[model samples]
Target: MDIVNALALFANFVAVPATAYGAQLALGALGVTLIFGILRFANFSHGELMSFGAMATILVTWTLQDLGIGIAPFPTALLALPVGILASIAVSLATNRMVFRFYQRRRANPIVFAIVSVGVMFVMAGLIRIIIGPDDQSFADGERFLITAFEFQKATGLKEGIAIKQTQVITVVVALVVVAALFWFLRKTRAGKAMRAFSDEEDLALLSGVNPDRVVQIAWIITATLACIAGTLYGLDKTYKPFIFLQILLPIFAATIVGGIGQPVGAILGGFVIAYSEVMVTYAFKKVITYLSPTDWAPEGLVQLLSTDYKFAVSFIILVAVLLIRPTGIIRGKVI
Candidate 1:
């Protein structure tokens, strides 16, 4: 129970992995929130969209690797991100035109739209599994760890070494840039303002000469881009599998719900909150606590709060709690 040691251990647990995971969840939640705001429905298919984008990036990266082209200090998948984004955009737009567009034309209820999205999710899930054969694929190569623990220890001459992966650093930086750009666009740009207008009041926006179809198209494109970025980063940091995307759905939804389904800022905050909670709750703090704690005060039992297998359950519990406490979300997201 040495306070200094306990604080340091907590910091380590909270800082690195939480940051990387928060960025990933934020990116995924951004897409979900945008769809909820603009399209006015919960997109259950978003996780599958992420999987599709990650798979596309993996394919492109492999192709580039075969050609002997790569980013030396970074993963080749980083270089192939744009291709993956474009492919995801195409898929999202095509889905809108073929499946959701019919429902839109008929002015379907929000509940019906939600149901349709679930159907779309199943279809996309099946498509990804068919293409990838439901196998795990590692898409990371090149620089593995950005700063090795030993290197940091050598440089700082501190007993505590901090290891940062190149992919992890990239994930944080890229997510920041993307989120900043999105906020700037939403707040300042003409097209971005138009999108906000549509989300705020579709009828009024239409009367204001905003093109509905164009706004919807742009929303889908932006969502696709965010999905591509998030999915690729997640794949790089962890491993890519069609099934993992489905598993990520709970965290993404948790973020969106906890933040307020249609609120952008809420989504970002919710992502980090969920990520840190899940990581902290499940992480075995034995090594970290031992490093900092005095021998006499250290607990006999492992300091983990929950098993890693229950990560999804943690997210679901948070989602439900948020729903009961503030159904509109912390940001007062529109219920409609």
Candidate 2:
């Protein structure tokens, strides 16, 4: 029973939430990695891009709810997700046309592009706050949980049982599907092949008649699509707040770098690693330990390695460590 309770506590505090968070981070990091591999610049504006998408989804979902539309057991935001994706695509295209294209034409240095993206980041970040405000918005609707804690314990007739949220399951499932589709698109499509060729050898790709503009357009579209999906999932799992997306930028970047800056597999791998570390390090294991310990033998301390207030600090520490210790990332130099 003690062992079971200990396992349940671990599942409740660390496994479930971290997995959902990791899935969200992985999707965001994938977009970042894709941009790094293909477009060759750190897209500092992606956080705002994500915020914009979530805002779009939330607004549309509200409108739909007001109109008496809902999916009952699942969130209506799922249905409204495409609207957010479309809005994000529009923003991405407009940004690329009005901003990034000039730099691309000039063949500017990557750092120059990075600086420009920083400026765009501020503008977009401000625009999202103006549209959505800086307050937390609850956009979730329908059934909130696949199983409640008490229900799970009752059903299992156990001292401890793990509860799983509907959003968490949905997030993981959606992320898996999206990743699979993306991998398929990249591996088996002509356009994806062209993009890969461009990323691999730009001069040769141009010589091979791959249109640069087409590639750029596709990259922006995919990045925006990814941003929307990730943002919407995150908002549904947590809550929608403009500023939170800005903070999320740190973990997404940390994941991308830890997985390997230009590697998709690395990005996904890095997200889970960072998420688990954050959760495990910050979580208090006192109750679980008490359950597992003999009578009056439990430790007195909280059994937490770090306070939850410093969760994001874990990502920062990991990011700095990775930069100093393994600049090539955990996966070595796999570019894409």
- For each candidate, the alpha-carbon lDDT, in order, equals 0.89, 0.90
TM-score of each: 0.94, 0.96
Candidate 1 TM-score, C-alpha based: 0.94
Winner by TM-score: 2
Question: All candidates: CA RMSD in angstroms?
Answer: 1.9, 1.6
Model 2 steric clash pairs = 259-266
Model 1 gets an lDDT of: 0.89
